[model samples]
Target: MPIPSTLIGIPASPGRAGGRVVRVAEPPGEPATGPAPADPAGEAARIEPAVELVSTRLTARAATVSGDAREVLEATVTMVGDPALLQNAQELVTERGRPAARAVWEAANGFAATLSSMGGYMAERARDISDVRDRIVAELLGLPAPGVADLDAPAVLVATDLAPADTAGLKPGVALALVTEQGGPTSHTAILARSLGIPAVVGCAGASTLTDGSAVIVDGATGEVGEVATLDEAVEAAAAAAVVTDWDGVGRTADGHVVPLLANVGDGPGAAKGAADGAEGVGLFRTELAFLSAAEEPSESRQREAYVAVLSAFAGKPVTARTLDAGADKPLPFLSLDGEPNPALGVRGLRIARDGSGGDGAGVLDRQLAGLAAAAKETGAELKVMAPMVATAEEARWFVERCRTHGIGRAGVMIEVPAAVLTADEIMREVDFVSVGTNDLAQYLFAADRQSGPLAALNDPWQPALLRLIGMLGEASERTGCPVGVCGEAAADPALASVLVGLGVASLSTGPGARAAVGAAIGGLTLAQCRERAAVARAAADPIDARRAVAALDG
Candidate 1:
């Protein structure tokens, strides 16, 4: 009999294994019989050891990982051990008269809720803290920690949810493909798995229904996971599948034309990892990562450390660091943010920087300019700072003036807003370079929320309108003598990379896995051929036509 095969979705991660299933079910609910802690002093004494233990575990784990993985873990540990969080717990226990455990749980939950509601970077940090708190609480109660998956043997890991820390602990050699019942494509697990070159599937319902010891196979390329009757068949499939590598260089067209391959980095570790993976340089180093994880606004020194780390990691290679782009979608708690009915359209990106009054006290523009200037002076790194969500020439001019006032010599703006694409010529004249953020560009062009399931169709980067936008930006770059690049999903896409290069995008920055494939593609074409192909792509009315045009050119 053939092995029963079932398809399921899960967040992607690295490695492949075959072992008996080890389901980590949620712990049974314990009754709330005990009264709340009557005193803050008593609660502090009770919770201190547990917090210390969590800190120790986190520290030990942080020491084991490399690159951004280490930074994120260490940051999480710091947040977990924060005095404010502990004091808040103590206060809750004293005021509510709840049990020590209950007080800590409620306080942590409240904090997490506050962070989540705050949105943007703070919310992401809040979620991290909540995860840590759950693990700490489990340790205190002697319960199996949530998100912990044991990898004592070779096996495919199945989980309802896997936190970043738990995912980091996964031994690539022992663990096979990861299948999860929940998580999105952009989730940390998915991003890490892609980084580690692991096969994973996410968002699969009823994944837990599969029996232990059932044979399985996962196809990361196609996002498929299923049970197999025979282990031999599974192994054969795994063996036959090609592993993706991150060897960087320049991308090429089918006819052989060079296209620089770069990496999108958010922090120092990310830059280091990208460099190690052979990224030509940092394509998009989001400066906001440093500020998001902290409870307080990051000082200039703190900002400098982050900027220097990234620049040093690249060893003097060019790093296009985007200035603070935080706003409604990515709320900063330290920044005073007024609630907006439509955050995507509201004050964000270059608008926030220009206005300087979008609730975060001092304008984001001032802080970003100061940070970039300080980082440049400290590291002497070849820094190219850009603004996000810029839609007009005037915004670009204001941004350039601010950068110059702070002594930043190189400045640019991202063309993500549709208005920017339409007015690229005017905008390009005010900056040193331009990079299209096609993800947001596509969403805004189609009037769709890229994050919404109902708007999936509109989120396609290959949509005709988005391609036209790229063409328009390219035309502006030509007219203004500004070097344009693309640091968006479309840039990393092997299928679309050639088209972007052909459209006069001077550089294409993407995730590591795409480097070689793109290099191979671009290596096959000449610059003129790419230009012609890009012209054809611009004229195409639909995705199918665009793909067909490129395919015909290759053939």
Candidate 2:
């Protein structure tokens, strides 16, 4: 075969996967609503059992996957058993003498259409609802839900897109890669693929057209895909990443400007893994994993043990821990966080601490703080605590004081909210340090939903607008004499990491996978060269132009 044209897409996960394509089959649609069954009761019994089966399937999937994918699957499982949906469908069978299949189909379709019209995140769920309907209908018809699970061979999953539900049962190595015509960095597919360490390229426009069994080289880091025998070898050769040798202590530019490199970890084991990977310290040791998995409110002792384990993982190295950053995506079962029409913008982060209605949420906050203090006392770990979603200096001060009262000597606020970024200088006066969570900052600044595939480009770290904000935060840090850091997914991109360091970010923290890549990238450039790239990038018209400008500087 002639060389295949390369397809560019968003790099949702970093790695390489090479294989033939295995397109997940489309569901057999609304099976013949053929001739109504004489007994509606028998149809109801069959339909209900099918629905239960789908629910059971989803629950099993949820148990298998965690983090974002687990949340989406659990939500789907609930949708399958929705009493309102079941009642409406059963009424058609019992009262209107309609076939159970048609009744369930119409009910699901009606609800799906209503949800689709809502637009934004909810509109995206129409596909999810449709998937649920197909699964139920397929089970009732003695057929299986359309999927690639039965495929014995390992291959790259190529399709228009795999719904969260569709991809839930995907085990690592079952599909060596995942390429789709649509998805964003924050999509469930992207999150799940990354968690599973499956190299993935999402939002590949023509990916669905790739011939089945055609060997392909998928580069997840750069979102490049092609059908060439030597593409993998060529990609590795062309990487041109900075030379990396295992000789690291603290990270510094060639010009010898000290800019500490750190790791963004989610759990205790993650901290140890990051340390083993040569991370000097933890930049973002997320504490939400403990609460999210807890069946009830975790005791102070439990929280302390968890905190101590992570702090000790670094072997007494500095670890910055963010207190319970939960809300929409990370729900606390004990807290009554009401569902929001758009939870991303609504109550989350430090807002939950402020949401301390009746003190249930407040107690969780205090308990967490006390645990950090206990851990610090027990392990002698230099644990720095920070609060998420602090908007004003007052909120910053309030958070600092809360931590201080709990015996935390050092505290800070994440500079994610634009207001906080703009007021970083003042907020820093009330805290010990500042860290920017650029993912959310970019989303809120651009007013684009992070999960929207079309809006994915807007969330690019190279965007001149986002660079300007990082520059502002850097300025704020210097003006206030507070240590400022970038602890976001943006820090994981080596090229972008170089620009971020140039933009005045004092430290960089990234996922464990990128720690060495970023450290190596930073080591190759002189401080002045980074400044040059940053200057060229800041003058660009858009993200693409900014990327080009920076690349030209490297050239």
Model 1 alpha-carbon miss at residue 308, Å: 4.0
Worst 10 residues of 1 by lDDT: 10-19
In the range 1-555, model 2's lDDT, one tens digit per residue, is: 111448977777766666667787767676556577788888777777888988987898789765445667877887899888888888878777767777888889998877655444455567688778877877766775766566697777888878888676677777778898887766667766765667788888888778777777776666777875543443443333313445375688888998888877776766777777788888988888788757698899998888887888775677899988877545567887776666667677788878754247777889989988888888877889888878899999888888878888889889877888787788889899989988778888899777677888787666788899888887877788898898977787667788988888899987655666677778889998998888888889986577667767756
RMSD of 1: 5.2
**How much is 217 displaced in model 1, in angstroms?**
1.8
All-Cα superposition RMSD per candidate: 5.2, 4.8
Residue-level lDDT tens digits of model 1 in 172-208: 6566667777664545566566555456666667777
How does candidate 1 score on lDDT?
Answer: 0.69
Q: TM-score for every candidate vs. truth?
A: 0.78, 0.80
Best by lDDT: 2
Q: Which stretches of candidate 1 lie over 4 Å from their true place?
A: 1-5, 8-45, 91-94, 243-248, 267-270, 289-306, 312-316, 327-346, 356-381, 404-410, 438-484, 488-506, 511-555
